[model samples]
Target: MQTLYLSRLQHYLFCPRQFALIELECAWEENVYTAEGQVMHGKVNSGGHDTRGNIKSVRTLPLGHKSLALEGVADVVEYRTDEHGVQIPYPIEYKRGKPKSHRADEVQLCAQALCLEDMHNCKVTEGALFYGKTRRRHAVTFDEELRALTLEAINDCRYIIESGITPKPIYSTSKCRNCSLKEVCHPKIFNKNAKAWLSNQITANLNEVRQVNNNDD
Candidate 1:
C-alpha cells in the first residue's frame, strides 16, 4: 500500500473532492476556517509538559505504520503505567467544531489510534476527541467496529488516489452549501446528468426484470 497521511482522512470526511484535490491533484487553497484550524493545531503542537502522578502528557508525537506506509504527528498522547508496570499510550485529536451526526470524526480519531498501535506495538484501546466549540473532550473507544471502519477508509483513500478519478459530485443542497469545494466541484451542474442516468438505469433494470418475471409466469 502507498503511504497515507492522517490528514487525508479529515479531508475525505469533509468532502471527497477536497481530499482528491489536496492529496491527488496537489491543489491547495486556504480560507479563514482552515487558517483558524491551523493556528489551533500549532498551539497544540508546541511542546508542553504536564504530569499527574504517573500519567504524563506528550504533545506532537510522530507516529507511523511502516507496513501500511502511513504516518503523521499525533496532537497529544497520554502515557501511563498499568499495575504490572507496563506503559500505555492513548492518542487525543483536537477539532475546531463540535460533534457531527456522522462517523467522519470518529474515522479520523480511529486513524490516530491505528497509528499509535503501529508505533507503540501495543493495543491502544481508547482515545479522546477534544472539540474546540464545546470545550470538552469526547472519549472514543477503539473497538473492533471502529478499527475496521478506519482500515476501510484508509484502503478507500488509497484506491481513490491511485485511480486518480474524482468521484461524481453528489448534489446535496445542504452538503453543497457547506462544502469548501462546492465551486470547484460544481456539484449542481456535474451531478445532474449523472443522477439522471443512474435513475434511468435503475428504472430500465426494474422494467426488464419485471418483464422477464411476467414471461415466466
Candidate 2:
C-alpha cells in the first residue's frame, strides 16, 4: 500500500474530489493562497531550530507510521521537558491563514500527533497549529473525538486511493471559490451538467480518432 500523506487529510476533508484530483490524478494548480502557504512552510522548514528554557525545537521532521501507512514532514516538533524530566513530542503545524470553521486543520494536526505517537511509542496528548495570519498557536488535544475523526479521514482517503477513481466535483461557493484548482475542477460547470459534459468529451475524443484515421489514409 502506498503511504498516505498527513497533509492530504485536510485536502480530503475540505473536498474529496480535490483530494482525488491531486492524489489520484496528480493534478495541481497554484493561486495566491497556496503560494503564500508554500512560502510560509518554506520559511518554517528552513532549519530555524532554537532552544528555550525547557523546550528544544526541531524543524522539518520527517514522520511516518507503518501500521497506518501514513507519512509527512512536520513543520516543527518541540521537545518539551516535563517536571519528571521526560521530554514529550509536541507537533506544531504552520498555516498561512487563520483558522476556518471546518475541522480540516484540526484533523491534519491530529493525524500528525498520531504519527508521532506511533513512531515514539508513547502518548502524544496534544499538538498545536500556528497560523501566520493570527500569529497564535491553536492547541489541539488528541481526544477521542478528534482522533476518531482523523482515523476516519485516513480510512476514507485509503478507500478513495485504492479505488483509483477521482471523485466527481461538488461545488460550494465558500469552499470552491478560493480553491487553486477551481479552473481545473470546473466544479460549478461540470457537476451541474455531468451527463452532458461526459457525452461531449466522449464525442470530442471520437472525432479526434476519426480525424487521425482519415489522415492515415
Candidate 3:
C-alpha cells in the first residue's frame, strides 16, 4: 500500500472527487473559505511545544506508520503524564468552519489518533476538534466504530487514488450547491444523459415494433 496522508481522509469525506482532484490530479484552487482555514491552521501549526507541569502541548507533531503506509502532522497533541510517570497522547485538530453535519471531521481526527498510536505505541482513546467559528472544542472518542470508519475510509481513498478515475458526479442539490467544482462537474449534464438514454430506449422499442408490423404486412 502506498503511503497515505491523514488529511486525505478529510478530503475524501468532504467530496471524493475533490479528494482525487487534489491528491491524484494535483489540482487546487483557493477560495476565501480555504484561505481562512489556512490562516487559522497556521497559528496552531507554527507554535512549538509548551510544557506546563505534567502536561506537554506539542504543535504540528509529525505522525505516521510505515507499516500502514500512512503519515501526517497533528495540529496539537496534549501529552499528559500520570502519577506513575506514564505518558498519554491526545490529539487536537483545528477546523476553520463550524461543526458539520457529517463525520468528516471525526474521521480526520481519528486518523490523527491512529497515527499517534502507531508512532508513540500509546493507546489514544480520544481526540479533540477545535472549531474556529464556534471557538469551541468538540471531544471525539476514538472507539471501535470510529476507528473502523477511519480505516475503511483509508482503504476507500487508496482505491480511488489507485484507480485514477473520478467517480461520476452524484446529482445532489445540497452538495452541488456548496461544491467548489460544481461548474466543472456539471451534475446536470450527467443527469441529462439519463434522460437521453431513456429516450433512446423508447425510440429503439418503437422501431422494433414497426419492423415486426412491417414483416406481418
Candidate 4:
C-alpha cells in the first residue's frame, strides 16, 4: 500500500477526483483561496513553541501512523493537564476559510488526532480547527463515526492514487469557483467536448453502416 498524506484525506473527502488529480496526476494550480491557505500555513510551518501556565502549544509537529500508512504535520498541538493532572494532546488545524457545507476540515483534524493517538498510545477524543475567516476555533470530536469516515477516506485516497488515474471532473460554478485547478481541469469544457466528440463518432459510424448496407443490396 502506498503511504498517503494525512492532509489528502480531507481533499479526498471534499472531492475524490480532486484528490486524484493532485496526488496521482501531480496537477495543481493555486487560486486566491488556496494562496491564502498557503500563506496561513507558512506562518505555522516555520515551527515554534509557546507556553502559558500549564498549557503549551507546539507548531508544525510531525505526525504519522504506520497502521494507517499516513504521514503529515499537524499545524498545532496544544497540551494541557486534564483532571487527573495528566497532559493531554489536542491537535488543532488552521484553515483560511470558514466552515463549509462539508466535513473535510474536521476529518483532517481527526486524522491528526488519530496520529497523535497512535504515537502516544493514548486516546485522543477531540481536536480543534481554527479558521482565519471566522477567527474562531471549531472543536471536533473524534467519535466513532468521524473516525470511520476518516479511515474510509484514507483507503479511498490510497486506492485512487495508487491506480494513477484521474477521475472525470463534475462541474459546478459554485464549487469550482474557488478551485485553483478549474482552468486546468476544465470540467465544463472537457465534459462538453467529450460529449460532442462521442456524438460525432456515433453519427459517422451510423453513416458508414448505412453505406455498407446499401452497397450489399
TM-score for every candidate vs. truth? 0.84, 0.88, 0.85, 0.87
By summed lDDT, the worst window of 10 consecutive residues in model 1 runs over 174-183
Q: Tell me the whole-model lDDT of each prediction, alpha carbons only.
A: 0.82, 0.92, 0.86, 0.86
Cα RMSD for predicted model 2: 5.4
Better of 1 and 4 by lDDT: 4
| Full candidate order by lDDT, most accurate first | 2, 4, 3, 1
**What is candidate 3's lDDT per residue for 82-108, written digit by digit as tens?**
788988998999998799988999998
Tell me how far candidate 1 lies from the true structure as C-alpha RMSD in angstroms: 10.0
Q: Model 4 scores what on Cα lDDT?
A: 0.86
TM-score ranking of the models: 2, 4, 3, 1
lDDT of 2 by residue, 1-217 (tens): 8999999999999999999999988999999999999999988898767899999999999999999999999999999999999889999999988998999999999998988888888899999999998999999888999999999999999999999988888889999999999988999776877689788889999999999999999
Model 3: runs farther than 4 Å from truth?
191-217
Q: Candidate 4, TM-score vs. the true structure?
A: 0.87
Model 2: which residue pairs collide?
A: none
User: How many backbone clashes are present in model 2?
Assistant: 0
Which portions of model 4 show Cα errors greater than 4 Å? Answer: 192-196, 200-217
RMSD per candidate (Å) reads 10.0, 5.4, 6.5, 5.3
Candidate 1 runs further than 4 Å off: 194-217
Q: Which stretches of model 2 miss by more than 4 angstroms?
A: 196-217
> RMSD (Cα, Å) of candidate 3?
6.5
Clashes of each: 0, 0, 0, 0
Residue pairs clashing, model 3:
none
Evaluated with TM-score, which candidate comes out highest? Answer: 2
lDDT of 3 at 103: 94
